[model samples]
Target: MKQVVQNYKSGELAVLDVPVPGCKPGGVLVRTAYSLISTGTELMKVSEAGMSMLGKARSRPDQVAKVMQSVATNGMSATYRKVINQLDSYTPLGYSLCGVVEQVGPGIDDVAVGDLVACAGNEHALHAELNWVPKNLYARVPDGLAPQHAAFGTVGSIALQGVRRGEPQLGEVALVIGLGLIGQLVVQLLVASGARVIGVDPDPARCELAERLGAEACGDPASAAVENSVAEITGGLGVDQVYLAAGGGSNQPVELAARLSRDRGRVVDIGKCRLDLPWNAYYEKELDVRFSRSYGPGRYDPEYELEGRDYPIGYVRWTERRNLACFLDLLARDNVDVEPLVSHVADFGDAVKTYQRLKDGELKAVAVLFRYPEAVEEGEAEAPSVAVPAVRRGTSVPAPARSGRAPVRLAFVGAGNYATSMLLPHLAQRDGVELSTVVTTTALSATNAQRKFGFARATTDLDAVLGDPSVDAVFVVTRHSSHAELTRKALLAGKTVFVEKPLALTEEELAGVLAAVEESGNDRLQVGFNRRFAPLLQEARKQFGARTGPASLRYLVNAGRLQHGSWYLQQSTEGTRFAGEGGHFVDTASWLLDADPTSVYAVATPGNEDLQVVLDYPDGSTATLSYVTSGPSGFPKETLDLVADGRALRLDDFVRASVYGRKRWVSSRLPKARDKGQSAELAAFVKAVRTGGPMPVPLESLVATTAATLAVRTSLVSGAPVTLARGR
Candidate 1:
């Protein structure tokens, strides 16, 4: 097996063909899939190795002090030999990795051979083809989570431990003084905990990336923009917590932490930064200083990590292994996204060159991964493509009698925030609805949904939900990547599917769903395009009356920034932002124009931060949709206008609407809140399910809207109008 090794004294890195580690008792032998590089901690070590002996001594005064004490005790000759031997020998690299178990030794029962697991520990999870990881240092990878993402478990655990140390609370303001890999993860964890974050970094690009990930504001540490943002968010009060995730010789991080922290605020050190604290500022604020050890309790303990000794959960809630599992669960549930943090994925054979580039500053990255040979081979296979079968209209299972039938048993495949807040809440207490089973990738999330929404049962077994004859409908509310696959399975199982919009990320996935429909002869499916069902917009369209000529429709979606760790930003795996959301606007426009679009043209800003999509209808009418993220948060999210035949209609963010013609008409302002039609949509869907009627939205219209939505991406890439093919 080949492993990455470094010589401290010679400053040389090599991918050496070393003996594969044996499957020791109380541990498992794993075949490496992917390994992560710690850009901050590992690079610092690399740079120190390249330095001369005197320079190395200067960089580590503590090691030098230890060396002097050793010399006094053991004499200069013995001490000198010991120090030289240690530096000249090859040392293994990497502390985090994802791999498939090849062998499970005695005393370990949690995992078995061939199971994928994320391993932690420098000695156990090295950058090698195979490793022997003790039971307590490895966690089973969550289902559907990519192995490359699981490789982030260790560093993610470190960030999670750091956030736990800070003791952040809901709605508190936090200032993160770094934007590196760990810092970025910390920012996301804080956001997930319901705290607002302000990020500081010297790199403008990093600061911008931080903001895109959910930071309220980010800028250079020296810039006034960061200070103003902190003041504005906290109402002139200092931030509740300050996290020092920066590394350097300067004293700025500690000083800034003291200056920005509120009175008695907690400051946690999570990185190897200069800690020369300024006494006066800290004394004035009386801040509580804390240090977060890597990966929480049991991190460096031999008994826990090497001997497989488990900690009592009642006393130690989160140990190293537990933290690893927690972070992996967060990744599985789409809560803390790491896909955006990945800058590069290099082959393991290029390990030496990759390290040199990073050390020489030739490569700029927040995080990098090493893909083993097996993973690379698997990745090279082409994704299967299937022809989209012809749409079979009005084909569905016969509905039972509407009178006194069992409540429509609906099973939800995901329990994320969107499902809980928008979809489940509407159906939870509805008279004719029964929340039967909630299936999630994580057991905890399934249990949470079962507890909150009164689900009959909760389990991670998706097969059980699909196979159950009593489950009348299945809601595919998981992340964008899983929608097509889940929907196809449910449709095959003869259950109605209510999937959230952006039905598919690619044409192939879309075709697969249609193929399933053709194979099963069932078209009982509804994509969650709730905008068309909005009562306010529906009423406005009715009041505007018919139009003889081509009408020009304008829809502006002020899609503001996503939270720092939103799964929506995982473009590589989940699809682009516009690809996931552009369907809603297209569907609504088609609903108003009363026809499917014949052509689509699209363009984007330089970094694809904003988009303008133009759709041409069969009647020569047109709709222009502008989706921008640079808009102010205080502004409304969705607003629309339609004008033709000397008449105009406007809908103000679903709050109010007006029509102008021979007789002017306007809607009364909505009192408590704006309704985007989730409740109404659910009601209509349930009614369709009970009566065996057609879907609320026609099957052809849904398919056309999805195809038109997909065309925008094609047009953006081709820089030309894409004509929508009508029919098979």
Candidate 2:
């Protein structure tokens, strides 16, 4: 596909041919209609004072120091090459987009071919020409909502979430301190909620536009609420609430909000503005100071949205969608007018002009569109790929399909540290599976991985595996986020698939994947909830599966190391570690307990990230899990304690674990099999394809557990424990 790219080497924007992203399971490929350019964000992103090389070195002194440290430790030549490569890579533009779903992946049921949807996540936005939005982050566009309006959903959601957190009460005054795109939206929502709004901006026109949008008053405020001045508006009592929405400023709002608020008033700081108030002023004011996060609770939740699970479509009314709908409602009610508020409408071309206009401050109000009409170049459209027709299952076939091979030619998708550090070492010793390829993001890494793992060849192209008919199955060890899409693609290409934990980011992704599974009509799906493969846990299950009484298990763990995973920050990749790692224990508990979790209650301490979860099932059996992503110093990674009527089993580090209460209290230990799990998981994938036996971990059961995992994240975010789901 011909695509728009920014050349950092030449500093020019050009259209060039690139690969159109392929569709994956539990995801959809989109063709862009319109994408919104964020003025304040993108301008700051690549501007002179910011994003430039010198600016970066000053802004991130620690990173610069790290590079110097690396040079001192490794060598100057290596360090210079690393930094230079980063400088050569051009940064992509645009994050919010609206488009039509062109192809649907497996297990996805909610959205279908030709459906209009809003792209929400950052990575998904990059594939505008042909994007694969994991079911987790894509929100269905409202029927009447314009594509332009849909394009703003993601950033609008961020603003909406901040406004919601301000907790504005009707009849209360709300002081919005900033006047950027987000700040303006926050002002509009507070106004929509019937709060008397006071808009603050350094720019004259932004304040004027806020006035036109029903702000009772607007100005470049030295103070949030002046005692005498606000007395005239509020009869001497300060504002009921204050919202710090400005960017880059520090301490000014902290002092202003303290003086401007009435006793026991609410101060929700929602922007990048800093706070460095004196202790005396803060303590004397007695205000409820709060920080607003991106979107509302359940924003990144997987169970509620992906895997085809719903957030009741009731009490949880809009979720991500409702936020967009609210923004649309304000627009439709004429409460917030973007048309007049918008000072720029650049087309999808001439992207450079957008940067120029933003730096000049000629862009104001809502800086919606980026490329200019005149500067946008007219180019020949790239030839679209001829899509293969969707094949309906259970229908007549043209002839007999190709015969199955004896020993499957296997390809493993991801080769990051885990693949090298864990899975590859095991796959090297396995049978019934031949390693042919290891795909990475770049050809260089793929080559490095190929030699290190003894693969015949490595290529950045996934089509190399998909196009090779000899390839029978795929073992996916990529970051958690891409698991669903890659698995879906593999399945559609008539290959058996296995993936690591937390099937997809959200229930939506799971649902879409389930749809793909249904479409495949093939029972060769498996999830690597590796704890089950641990010799100790497997024995615990074997022991309890035979008993009739209730069983219990505990995954005593320290979570510090998890914080280092970059994928963890990207929810789709690592998931909330609660689900990514802890959910595996949840699934293990369900297995050892011989029952599915019927309900779960999670409680987290104040100023803590760890959550204590209780999973209850029928027959009075229960399991407890401590979701700790932060750990005590020098703590062991994982341990499990299990029990039934008269028997208790202890498992530690996949090496030494034994049962004590019954059956002679046998004591045994694993002789440190470092990579048994990778081998076992692959063997299961191949076995499921060959013999059709029960999988080590059933996809359906794994899907259910993932839903529960998502529930825990939602509960934590909402500060309310989520109830257990019975069926799905």
Q: Of the candidates shown, which would achieve the greatest TM-score relative to the real structure?
A: 1
Per-residue CA lDDT of candidate 2, range 1-728, in tens?
Answer: 54455544344444555778878777788777656766666555455233557766765567789999999988999998987786666556667777778898887888888777877665666523666777756777756554555667777777777777777888988877777777777777787788988777767656655665556677767643334446667777888888887766367777777877888888887776667866777688788888775555555567644553556666766566567556655554445545433444445555556565566666443555432121112210111111111223333212113335555566878888877887777677566556888888877878888888778768788987877877766778887778878878877676767777767766667766766666766545677776656555666556544767777766666676332224463332245556667667787777777666666666654212456887777777877887675577576666777777877777666666676654644436655663335566666666666654565666557766877776664444322345554432
Error of 2 at 44 (Å): 34
- Model 1 scores a TM of 0.62
lDDT of 1 by residue, 138-219 (tens): 9999888878889999999999999999999999999999899999999999988999999999987678777767788898
Q: Score each candidate by Cα lDDT.
A: 0.87, 0.65
- Residue 663 displacement in candidate 1 (angstroms): 56
How far in Å is the alpha carbon of 413 misplaced in model 1? 23
Candidate 2 stretches with Cα past 4 Å from truth are 1-406, 540-545, 561-565, 572-574, 606-608, 662-676, 690-694, 717-728
Clashing pairs counted in every model: 4, 27
Off by over 4 Å in 1: 378-503, 506-516, 519-575, 578-728
Per-residue error for 701 in candidate 2, Å, reads 1.8
